[model samples]
Target chain A: MAIQQFEHGKMTLEQFEILLDTLGTNFDSWPKMKQAEARNLAQTLDGKRLFRGAQKLEMLMMALQSTPQSTSQSVPESSSESPLVNSAVTPCDTQKEAFLEKLADIPRRYQQNSAHLTVCNRMTLFVTQALAVNSDGSRLFSPQRLASQAAAFAAVLAVGILVGITPEETPTGSGEIDLSETWFVASSDFELGE
Target chain B: MPNRDKADDTILVARVCAGDSDAFRLLVIRHGARFRMLAMRFTFDQALAEDVVQEAFISLWLKAGKFDGAKASFTTWFHRIVINKCLDYKRKRQFSALPDGYDRADPAVGPEVKLAADGASNRLKTVLSALSERQKTAVILSYYSGLSNQEAAEVMQMNIKAYESLLVRSRAKMRKMLMAEKDDLFAAFA
Candidate 1:
C-alpha cells in the first residue's frame, strides 16, 4: 500500500509547535510588538519552557506593582538594633500586614485545615489501638481462644469419627459383641464346676 | 499596562522575597489562568486544576527570591512550579486509588453520548475522550493551553526528543481520528 502524505508542509514539529504558540498568543491579544519580541525570545529558550531575558524583566515589572511596599521605616528602632536589622524587620512587618488584609478572602483554608486535623486525629487514634493490640503479649489476641473454638468443633468431629469407626449391627446380629456372655466366661464359678 | 511594564518581575520577586503578600497575589492574577489550563490538561478535572494553580502560586511566593532570570525565563520558572504541583497531585491520587485504574471515561456512555452530541464543546470532549491520556495531555497543552513543545516538555518533565515523539504520536492520532469522522460524514453524503 502506498503511504499517504498529509500536507504538514516543510515545517518541523518544533516550528509547528511555535506556530501554535503564536496562535495562542494572538488569541490572548498579546500586542504585536510583544508577540514579535516573544517569538524571538522563545527561539533563545529553545528547549526550555521559560521566557528569559527581557521578557522576564517585563513580567517582573507587572508583578512588582501588584505587591505593596513597606513603610515601617518611620518606626524608631531600639539602640541595640542595627540598621540592617531594622530594614529587615520593615519588610517582614509589611508582609504580615498584607497577609492580615487578605486573610478574610481565604475562608476555605481555615475550614480545610480544621477538617484535616479532625480526620487526622481520628485516624491516629485508630492506628494507636491497632498497634497496641498487636504489640502487648498479654493484651494481644490469643491463638488459644481460636483453638478453643476449634476444640469444640474437634469434639463434634471426634464423635462423628467414632460413629464411623464402630461396626454396624446386622439383622442376624452376627457381628454384635455380647457383653453378658463375655462376663459369664470370665467368672470363677464356671471354671470350678468344670 | 504602562504601570505593569515599569514594575518588573525582579522588583516583584524582591518584594515577595521580602515577604510582600500582595506581590504574590499579583503573580497569581497574572499567570493563574494559564497555570489552571496547564493543570486541567494534566488532571482533566477543573477543581483539581484550580487547587494545582493555587499550590503553584503559593510555592512561587515562598520561593520568589530563588528565581534567577539568568538561568531561565520567569514564565518558565513559574510553570515549572505549577507542573511539579500537578505531578504531586497525580502521585497522591495514585496512592489513594490504588489498583483501580484512573481512566477518565464516563461509566454511562449511552447518556453521555447523547449529552455530548447536543453541544459543540461537548463533542470536542467526546473526541478528546478517545485519545490516550498522554496524547490528550500533549495536544491540549499545545493547542488549547498555548504551550510550546519546550514548555510542554518542561511541564511533562520529559526530554525534548521524548516530548517531540509524544507530540508527533498525539497529532497523528488526532488526525487519524478526525479523518475517520470526516470519511463517515462523506459516506453519509454519498
Candidate 2:
C-alpha cells in the first residue's frame, strides 16, 4: 500500500495546522487497537523523564535544609549549669529539643552541600518540629529521634544525588558532631566496657 | 499548597523522595488533571478515574526515587503507572462490577465542544470508537497524544513498521467513516 507520510517534522505552520485539523476530525474512527496503542504512546511521549540524578540531588537538598540548626548557637548562653536545670525540663522534653536543634541544621548543611538546593517554603513545619523538640527541655535527645533525623537527611541527600546535583562536601571543622553516627559508636563502646 | 508551575516535577519528585509532604502536594496539583483524563479513558467512569489518578500520584510519591530520566520521559513513565492502575481497576471491576456505569453516553462530548462550536470533534470521537483497539490507539497517540511514530510504537510495544501500518489503516478508516457520516447528515438535511 502506497501510504502517504505527512511530513510532520518539516511541514510549515499552515500545513501543520491543516494536518492537525484533518487528523482531529478523523480521529474518532481510528481502530480500537490503534486508539489504545496511541493512548499508550501519547502517555509516553508527553514529557521528559524525571532524571534520577536530579531527583536525588533534590531529595538531599531538602533533607539538609529541613534539619534544625545547632541549639548551642540558637539558645542563650546562660551561666546556669544546665539551661533546663531551673526550668524543670523533663527527659522527653530535652530529647525533643535536641531533635529539633539537629533538624534545623539540616538546611544549612544542605546549603553547604549544594547552592542549587533551595529551601522549599513549606518545609518549615518539619524544621520547626525539629527545633521545637530541641527546645522542649523534657526528653534528652534520644537515639530514636536522632535516627529519624538522620533518615530524613539521608532521604534528601539521596534525592540530590539522583538528580546529578553535586552536594557540597560536609564542611570541614564545622565542629558539629554527627550524633546519629556517634550514638552507635558510644553504645558499642559502652557494651564492650560492660 | 505549593505554587503551580514554580516547582518543576523533577524538583517536586526530589522533595517528595526526601520526605517533603509539601513537595508531594505540588506534584498532585501539577499532574492531577492529565492523570484524571488517562484514568477516565481506561476505566470509563469519572469516579474510578479520580481514584486511579490519586492512586497513581501516591505511588509516584513513594517511588519518586526510582525515576531515571534516561529510561523514559517522566510523563510517559507516569502514564505507564496510570495505565497499570487503570488496568488493575478493570480487573477489579470485572469481578465486582463497580457501582458506576459507563452508559454509552458520549465520552468526549463536553465543554470543549462549546468552544469548537463545530461538529468536527463529535464526529472525531464517533470515528475513534469505530476503530479497532490497536489502530485507535495509534491514531490517538499520533494525533492527540503528540507522540512521534517511534515513541508511539514503543508505547504500543510494536515494531515501527507495524505501527506505521496501523496508523495508515486507522487514518483511512477514519476518513471513510467521516465522509460517510457527512454524506448521511447532508442527505438527511436535504
Candidate 3:
C-alpha cells in the first residue's frame, strides 16, 4: 500500500508533515486507508528526518521508562506484550495461578462496593431532597419563593438603573436634595469627590 | 484474539454493572496486569501502581452502570478510570523530594538507570518538570503508554486536537532541549 500510494503521490509535503506529527512515522495504528500513505511518506527524505526525531524522543522515553523497580514484593512476570515490546512478551503461568487464587474474593469485594455505591446514592438523594425542601414541607423552589426572588431582583435592578441615571445630585420639586451616588465611580473621581 | 478479548470485556462490564461480582473477577484477571503495567509506567511505584489499579477496579464496580457501549468500548472507558487515578496520585504527590514520580516509585534503582541518571536523564527531567502538568501527562499517556491520540485525549478529558497539539509542542520542546544536551544524552545512552 505504501508503494502504491508512493507511486500515485497521494499526499502533499505539508499533509505528510501533519501525518508525521500526529501519528508518527509508524503506520501500524493508522487507518487502513491512510496507513499506505503514511508508510509511503515515511520513506521519503523529509519523512525520514521527522521519523528520526520521533525515534529519538521515543528512545529518551524508553530511558525514562527503564527506571529501577524499588519494590520488594514479587510481581507477576511481564506477560502482556504489544508490538512495541516485540521481544519481551513471555508467559507468566505462575502469575495466572496466583491471580486466579485472588479471583474468588471478587464477589465479596464487589458486594461490599455495590453496597457502598447504594449507600452513596441514597445519601446523595437524601441530601439533594433535604436541600430543596423547607421543614414546613414546601419546596425551596416553590413558586412563591421564586416570585419573591424575581420581585427582589426587579427592585434591585430598578435601584441600579436609578443610581446609574441619577449619578449627579438633583433637587426635586419637594425641595429634597439627592446626593450623587459614587458606587460605580472611578477611584480617582471618588477620591476627588471625598 | 484482541477483538474477542474486547468483546469479553464488554460482556464482563455489562454483568458487573448488573452487580455480577463473578464477571468482575474475570474482568480483573483479564485486564489487571495491563492496568498494572500502565500504572507502573505512570507512577513507577509498585505499591502506588497497585493502589491505582485497585481504585480503578472499585470505580468500575460502582460506576460501570454508567458505561455506554454505543459510545466507546469498555477498554477506552476503563482507560479513563485508571489514568484518572494515576494522574490523581501524581498530583497529590506533586512536591515530593523525589525528582519525578519515578524516583518515589522506587528507592533503589537498577544500575543502568543510575549511570544515565548522572547525565542526560536528570537534565531531561528538569526540562520535563518545567512543562505544565497536563503537557507532561499527555506525553506519558501517549508516548510511553502507547495510547492513540484520541484515547489519550479521552483519558485526560481533553479534545483530541488539543491533545495532539500538546503532544506536538511537548515533543518539540523535548527535541529542542535534547538538541542542546546532545553530548550528555549520547554519554548517558551510549
Highest DockQ: give the candidate number. Answer: 3
lDDT of 3 at B90: 86
lDDT of 1 by residue, A94-175 (tens): 3333332333123223222223234544444343233233323442325676688899999999999999999786645576
Q: Give a tens-digit lDDT track for model 1, residues B1-190.
A: 4323222444454455555545545554444545655665566555576667766665555445456644555676777777667667877874232111123333433443323222323334455667776666676666555557887777667877787767666554444444444333222112
CAPRI class of candidate 2: incorrect
Leading candidate by lDDT: 3
Worst 10 residues of 2 chain A by lDDT: A47-56
Residue A187 of model 1: what lDDT? 73
Error of 2 at A185 (Å): 44
A178: Cα error in model 3, Å: 84
Task: Tell me the tens digit of each residue's lDDT in model 3 across A10-102.
Answer: 677666655555555467876677777677767889776666666666666666565432111233322232122323322232333344335
TM-score per candidate: 0.39, 0.39, 0.52
lDDT, model 1: 0.47
i-RMSD of all predictions = 20.6, 22.7, 10.8
Q: Model 1: how far is A98 from its true place, Å?
A: 19
lDDT tens digits, residue span B57-158, model 2: 656655565665446555666766776676677667652443243232333334333223223333444566688766766765664443578877877778
lDDT over C-alpha atoms for residue B40 of model 2: 46
Using TM-score as the yardstick, the better of models 2 and 3 is: 3
lDDT tens digits, residues B17-50, model 3?
6676767766775566667667765664545777
- Pick by DockQ: 1 or 3, better one: 3
State the local distance difference test value for candidate 3. Answer: 0.61
- Between candidates 1 and 2, name the one with more favorable DockQ: 2
